[model samples]
Target: MSRPNCEDFRHLFVNDTPLMDMRAPVEFTQGAFPTSHSRPLMTDDERAAVGTCYKNKGQDAAIDLGHKLVNGDVKAERVAQWKAFCEANPDGYLYCFRGGLRSQITQQWLKEAGIDYPFITGGYKALRRYLVDTIDEVAAKPMSIVAGNTGSGKTIMVNVLANGLDLEGAAHHRGSSFGRYVTPQRTQIAFESDLAVQMVKKLDRGIEHFVFEDEGKNIGCVTVPLSINRAMQEADIAVIDDPVDVRLARLLDDYVVKMQRDYVAHYGEEQGWILFAEYLEKGMFNIRKRLGLERYEVMLKSQQHAVKMMQSNGSLTEHDAWLAPLLEQYYDPMYTYQLSKKADRIVFRGDYHQVQDWLAAR
Candidate 1:
């Protein structure tokens, strides 16, 4: 039960060792490791009480109150939960805000219960710092940015790469107003943690070249790490040259069919459609500045018509009328202007399959 058999702290990042976050639910929700499960050493109320004691009386008083609060059946139940987690994941480690009192106490209690488990050396804050530092360090390496018109299946191509990192996937967004997913986006810290984890895994595998979709500074609410964004700005661009029709079909599949499916899966069918329609409306409204009031109204009307047609058991093709014009008038010009500014960065330009082959061969 001693700390001699403790797992190495870096192993938590590089390997699949599970982590039991002993921070309260509120703290854990704010941020924690991906592999972590919330198993608090104290309830939120108990933690607040202990914190107040620390502030008012001192550390000794807080410790006394903490022990007093978690004693008897409450302590026993928590120990049981920790024991179960340890038993299930023999390599599991525990952590607190600073790898200090709380985790030490948890480890000590578990030790007394005959469950010999080690905790993270520096705790949640330390591990988070390490992960954040790793992101900038890894961002120094060369990156290849996948670029194409909207709906060119650039995300799919990035995903198919051997060394591809899905920035949008990490953000739980498609990187646009309409790109909201049924699931919530990660907190900023969580998004950075995820991005760092991907890079760490790739680097650990001896891969130096990282590939990902070209993205703006923000993917939804999460900003790309500054260093990574800088590298992306300097990275070579791989463009997808699929025809308009091909790209349009992909947009429909992703935006309409897959989006509706996700919404229904999260919220039942009846409510899902309603939410989906709202999402579309919001997405359109969000782009009103770029679309101009008149053009926005036109697009909105077409979108509403498409929604009604779908509701009436009409074909998805009905969406093409608005989508095509939206792309032609809005998305294409923006993307083209952006790409033109970086014309020197374009490394490979081809159709989807051609790009796939080009990446695979590399």
Candidate 2:
């Protein structure tokens, strides 16, 4: 019996289908789908050898080298791994860089092992193209920008909306100097793949109008796709106009309280506290030039005192000393200037609930 080739890329992504990536480890590390697991047919060295043979001799010679390299116990071991993955993810499909020789050989081996499995028709390249197209297609729809000063709960508001696209969430950074999480952000390729998959899933649910947080091109290390960024620039803006105290409290919770808790959770109490302090200090140091030498010095001193106080008494309130000034002196003015440039695009300006309601109604 002949095994079928899976070509419904949207179905695979929408359902979060398990994918067995047969590319070399180096290729998988560069980029892969969220559901993809790297189970390469050739090691990087083996692939390099075969590639050289293909260039110097030809495809037939390359094939001979690949067989010789991955034969005997090696071949049986790989087949066993594939069989286990197939049994575990009965609905999963396998693919290589292209729907070419590597995947075909794997499928044939699986068949010989008495387990027939399908491969993606166009493989990794095609799947990536599908996701890219999804982003462009969804970005063409109507969109709304959630714009506000730092810590105005814009991200929170975005999460509350049905049509909202949390770009920062996809990028895994909070979109600020203090936004780096305890965990590292995704690779640029992975970030784009994630964002594109999100668009696909959201659009599948019939969400035509997308709500996105106001952001520049870069969100920490990852970039918003140019198509989506352009749409955001042209989209209507909904400003979350919370009081200064409210914004400050929100920021304190997010940056200091929760961030500390995250570090502690990840690294245990002692080391977590040290790393937490270093994280904040590094954030401050990163913006020293922009904050001005004198002001930065003052703020850094306050921040250091706040960290010590928190370490001693578990008092998070002391963070407000530097955080308040950071917002008032640095973030507020900068955001206010940025907002002014997009003033013409402002469609609704209200506190969190009102903005939430406005976005929901849209």
Candidate 3:
């Protein structure tokens, strides 16, 4: 049977197929495709040793040493793992850094052992370059920006649209100091890869235009790619204008109730509550400079009282005390000022359902 080499980039990512990454774990941890899993051909130290041998004694000597280092049970075990994965995910592809020596060895061994699987032609590097280039191409198309005040459910609006790129979701952040999620953030490279994947998927669907929430250059530690960020800045804008009460309720549901539950799910109850309280207070404290000394003190006092109320009353209403002022005194004015600068970009301004309907019809 002829071995299949290389994979169609769009199909691999759009379908969310399995990928067996044959690079060392150290390399895989830094970044990888979304659905890919690490199944390294050699241990990091082994790869290192082989590299040293290649530099010292050349390719043939390095190959012999690599074989020697991974022979017998080690080789058998690695092949067995690949075989099992192939059996379970028959369409899955294997890849190495350059799709050269390591992946060739893996395919040959798997073939000898009565298993045959394809590897991406240019491997991880090629696929990554394809994705990077794809993003630049896709970002050149027209797009829209979903602009809203804090707690205005702008994320929900953008996410509900089939064609929207949820930048905050891609970055695993809500795009605010208080927006940390229970999950660890993606590495910067991983973030860019994921964002590109999202754009490519949209492109595959024949989507020429996409929507994104208005975001700064950075989302948490990960920055939006320059081309895409420029597109977002220049895109037509839709504003979500939910009432303060509604926005506050949404914010509490997202930041407090949901966040607390996520914390509890990840940590135990006691520890989760402690962390929840800590994060809540820290989020408020983080904006101290912007909030000013007197306003910050008031907000802090209100926040401390709200925490006490949560512990004693098990009610979220106390949070509204601080949240309302925080929005009015801080977030509302701040967002309004920012929105003013982009007034010419505004295409539609309405409540949540209205924005959703407009996007759906588009």
| Candidate 2 residue lDDT tens string, 1-362 | 33234887877888898999999999999889999999999999999999999999999999999999999999999999999999999889999988899999999999999987899988899999999999899889999999999988988877778888888988999989999999989888888899888888888898999998999999998889999988888889999989989999999999898999999999999999999999999999999999999999999999999999999998878888899999999999999999999999998999999999989998
* Candidate whose lDDT is highest: 2
- Model 2: lDDT of residue 274: 95
**Order by lDDT, highest first:** 2, 3, 1
- Full-model lDDT for every candidate: 0.86, 0.91, 0.88
The 10-residue segment of model 1 with minimum total lDDT is: 1-10
Clashes of 3: 1
User: Clashing pairs in model 1?
Assistant: none
What's the C-alpha lDDT at position 270 in model 2?
97
Output the number of the TM-score-best candidate: 2
Q: 12-109, model 3: which lDDT tens digit per residue? A: 88878899999998899899989988889999999999999999999999999999999999999999999999998997899999889999999999
lDDT of 1 by residue, 22-96 (tens): 998889888776788999998888999999999999999999999899999999999999999999998678899
